[model samples]
Target: MSRLLLLSGGLDSTAIAAMTRPDQCLTIDYGQVAAQAEARAAKQVATLLGIHWSMITVPAREVGAGLMTGTATDPQGPPDAAPEWWPFRNQLLITLAAAWGVTRGITVVEVGTVASDGARHLDGTSLFLEAIDHVVASQEGHIRVRAPAAKLGAVELLTTSPVTEDVLAWTHSCHRANLPCGACPGCTKRRETLAAVGLLQ
Candidate 1:
């Protein structure tokens, strides 16, 4: 069965790409501030991994909230919303990927969610995965959603992946800008995860 991976060029997704080497890799630019950097990193990683990569632009900055949108926490966001939380962001990405996949005869859509992701956003939880899987499976395409690394943390995922340090270095996790704003949650997580994996000193 053909598989499509929703690659974000982050630690988790990059590791997943190295491990699975899916049939196709997709990077979406949903108007996030770091879209360019993320796309660049994803393209570079895909090239290095010999995986075909494609990107689509579906601007949604108008509806985006939190750090990724260059805005403060949306007043209407959930009480437990993280600083970089985007409303239904994962759902949107999954739907878009499935839409893109179905036309290409893809049977499975994979995301790069890790265990720690659930702590920051409900969409990263297994429950969310199961729910989204059901929702998407019930649709016309019947494409299945999977997160093979969902049970592992970033460090663990990286360690288990075949990705080398050079390829891993190509990942971009900054949510605020093309160049990393080290203070942002995305950058901080990347830094910490790299260090935990002994890729950084």
Candidate 2:
């Protein structure tokens, strides 16, 4: 059975994609920061991994109304507070990936959501995965959403996922990654997570 991975060109998703060793991968241009840049990174990583790759565009400005949309990361305050959320991004991404999987005879759709993602992202939770699983199952056994890192914290994922420096080289973790603005929340998170695993400077 073919596995369809949702590639985001971020550390977590890239790690998940590496572990899945999927037959093919799909990524979306959600108009997020570094959208095109991340797409380029995804293509690079997918090629390096010998996985077929395709790209899609999501109307993120239309569907996403959170900090990730560039509105405001933290209308409130604190590091792990208001701006930490991204609405239903994972659900939407998985739903689209599952639909594509069903059409391609791919039974498994790999996602990159991790346990530490709960600090800000609600859709990264098991509940959201369960809900999306039902959505895929409703279409029969054609597709299933898989979150390999969902049970693992960022430290565990970074430490144990089969991602090499080569794959990590293809990542664009900065939320404002035109040139990798390492100051953004996403970059900070990635740096901290990797540093926690002793992989970052």
Best by TM-score: 1
Structural similarity to truth (TM-score) of each candidate: 0.97, 0.88
Q: Write the per-residue lDDT of candidate 1 for residues 1-201, one digit (tens) a residue.
A: 999999999888989999998999999999998999999999999999999999999999888888899766353477788889898999999999999999999999999999999999999999999999999999988999999999999889989998899898899999888999898889999999989977788
Which pairs of residues collide in model 1? none
Candidate 2 lDDT, 1-201, residue by residue in tens? 788888888888788777778888898887676777789889998888888999998667555544456666553333454453555667778877876678778898888889977656667778888888788877866577788889898778877878898788778877754567767777888889878877777
Give the C-alpha lDDT of model 2: 0.77
Model 1: how far is 152 from its true place, Å? 0.5
Show model 2 residue runs off by greater than 4 Å: 71-81
**CA-lDDT, candidates in order:** 0.92, 0.77
